[model samples]
Target: MADIDLQIACEAPALPDAAFVERCCSAALDKIGRDGALAVRICEPDEIRQLNRDFRNKDKSTNVLSFPFELPEHIPDELKLELSELGDIVICAAVVADEARAQQKNLNAHWAHMLVHGCLHLCGYDHIDDNEAEQMEALEVQILADLNFANPYETL
Candidate 1:
């Protein structure tokens, strides 16, 4: 199951439908061997920029932001599985579209990449260091390939 709910807070006439987004998220979850739920919100750049500033302190909008589910400290790891919520992914449609055009990537493919990347982030995969980045990118490439998308990190 895709197990993802999509919310559109901005005009999304050009965005992919929920089914496609679910497929991308599902592929990423399956690659990482997890069964959970996620909330994906498509928002305007202004809202995203505010969120980036408030949460990440970046003060700029980005393509995607992942908020992983945080369990209470008292919750046992074994019992935490009962929650099975992967948290949320927020995508800025304008930023993503601009990035796709600037990076010379297929718009849909770039969307898929962002969804997959967000799913991985929800699963605790990050690219903070070179080794971690390589590992994450390799996994992303493999998952995207499984979904028939080309390598996203390669320059066009």
Candidate 2:
């Protein structure tokens, strides 16, 4: 099972519950054929904006950010056996909610998309170019579909 440490740092009452978050994240991890431990932090816009500015060099708040963990090469192999650390996924609750409404998407489906997107990032998936985007987006759509969610990229 994928180990997820969920941290809800926002005051939004509409945020998804722990079980739903785990199910979404786990589905992504399983689809990507990755097994590990990760953290999911749900925070407010201000916090996400600060993170985006500091790490991504963007001043705006994004819906999600993924920080993949890298173990030092010097660490002994035996030590690595115990913990399969993936990384952290920071999602802005306000941004997610707004985007769901703006996109006319089911809130739960949107949330699943964000979590799956982050999990893919944690597994070294990115869309820096057209080809890469195609690959990643295809995987995302398939994973979401497996979870019974509609294609997130569907036009409204």
Candidate 3:
């Protein structure tokens, strides 16, 4: 088994319950495997907007933003590990709620989708193009199904 470091921070008032957060983190780590460390931060809209602007150059608040670490081909001995440290996943609870409503999905399902989506991003999945989108969406469906959630791409 790999080392899993799951951190959940509620930097916003609209954050979900502790139990829900714990479940989300556990589900995410399970899907990502036990090897890597993941940090999930639940933030307010403004906080996410700032990060979106700073990192992605987008001024709007996004549901999730993944900052992946590009490791070199060869790392120092001290940096070598069985599992890698996946970068941070910042999620905006407010944005999530808005999206859930807009997409006509239950809160739990939407949150699950975002958590899985963020974890996939940490694992180097991207959807900048149509082909990538198809692959990523397929993976998302499979993972979410394994977690017993509905297909995230399914329309209501």
Candidate 4:
């Protein structure tokens, strides 16, 4: 299996350490059978809000945002083998922490869920429709279960 190269940038002091974030991302990649490079940025609410507004046209901060890298169809096989860039995932530390608290969930568990969710997005999973959401959510539950975490969708 190829290596999962993770580049993490944390702009918030309250966010988890780089090592923990990397482990979470690596687990997600391993579960999905994808080995590639991805960036995970832990930012302040303001930065995430700006990113959400600029890219998604939403003026509020979300827990996470995923930007998948699209490869050209005409790329040579040789070049494709050397290209490992998957995409970027931006997470709002404040929003994640707040949500975890409000939901009465463990912080680490919620963070792992966010990382897994973002990784799935990079791999072309989305929740735009009911069917898509069910599939994605099921995959997430399985992956999290493998990591010894409870289902995120289950109410406490």
Candidate 5:
């Protein structure tokens, strides 16, 4: 594991809890365990939509996106390089708020969920398949539980 440089910037309508942001980032880095650097940016919907189209060729804003450092898969562990410089996470605050309301959850908890999900992506985790989804969601539940949030997947 190499040193991880984590940078989190929030550019949205309202500022979030500074301590919560730090905790979330720290938890991510802890999970990443110094494999690489990470930059997490919380943005507005329009800004995220533009990024979604520009990078992913998608026209709508999504909750999160992860871009890993350009690297080869066969690299040795010590020589593996810092892929975690992992890239950025663009979250739409309005979308998060709306989702929270729709799901009948605390806004902060939803924010934490998205942040954790994005961080997991930064650390090379994904949910593109069923098995992967289970693993990733399990980890998310454990992490969020540590933060005193309820199991995110529980049915209301």
Candidate 6:
């Protein structure tokens, strides 16, 4: 099994403890069969909104934003073994809480879903198309199920 180095920075009171976030991230990485280093930042609405607007051109707060690392193609083989930095996940505590409440879903489950979603993004999974969305969602559902959580897409 590969090792995952996860760093969690919480800027909101609603965010869970570092240990819980680390577990969620580790589970995601394990499901994807990857070992990497990543950072999860739990921030407030304003922080998320600014990031969304700047990076995605959306002037609103989102539940999460993923910044995947792209390595150069010409890197030496030996260098690749020492490089494990995957990317960063920025999650908005308030937005996640609100969405979970509005969707009538469990808070912890929803948070796990977000973490899994972000980690998948780091692994180059995207939902820009229907087919891609289906594939990604299936992986997410399977991962969540393995973690004893319900399918995130299923209505409550």
TM-scores, one per candidate: 0.95, 0.96, 0.80, 0.88, 0.78, 0.89
How many angstroms is residue 108 displaced in model 3 relative to the true structure, after the best TM-score fit? 0.4
Ranking by TM-score: 2, 1, 6, 4, 3, 5
Give a tens-digit lDDT track for model 5, residues 20-122.
7657656755765644555556677788898889988999977766665656777777765433456666677878888888889988888888877887887
Question: Cα lDDT of all candidates, in order?
Answer: 0.92, 0.94, 0.75, 0.84, 0.72, 0.84
Q: Write the per-residue lDDT of candidate 2 for residues 18-71, one digit (tens) a residue.
A: 899999988988887888999999999999999999999999999999999999
Where model 3 places Cα greater than 4 Å from the true spot, the runs are 1-34, 71-74
Decoy 1 TM-score against native: 0.95
What is the alpha-carbon lDDT for the whole of candidate 4?
0.84
Candidate 6 deviant stretches above 4 angstroms: 1-11, 72-77
Candidate 4 clashing pairs, residues 3+ apart or interchain? none
Candidate 4 regions with alpha-carbon error over 4 angstroms: 1-14, 72-74
Clashing residue pairs, backbone N/CA/C < 3 A, model 5: none
Residue 106 displacement (Å), model 3: 0.9
Lowest lDDT sum, 10 consecutive residues, model 1, at: 11-20
Give per-residue CA lDDT, model 3, range 55-136, as digits (tens).
Answer: 8889898999988766687877677664467777788888898988888998888888887788778877889999999998
Error at 132, model 4, angstroms: 0.9
Clashes of each: 0, 0, 2, 0, 0, 0
Q: Give the least accurate 10-residue stretch of model 4, judged by summed lDDT.
A: 1-10
Decide which is better by lDDT, 1 or 6: 1
What's the lDDT for residue 120 in model 4?
89
Candidate 6 vs. true structure, TM-score: 0.89
Candidate number with greatest lDDT = 2
Model 4, 38-114: lDDT tens per residue?
88887778888999999999999999999998889999999999898889888888899999999999988999899
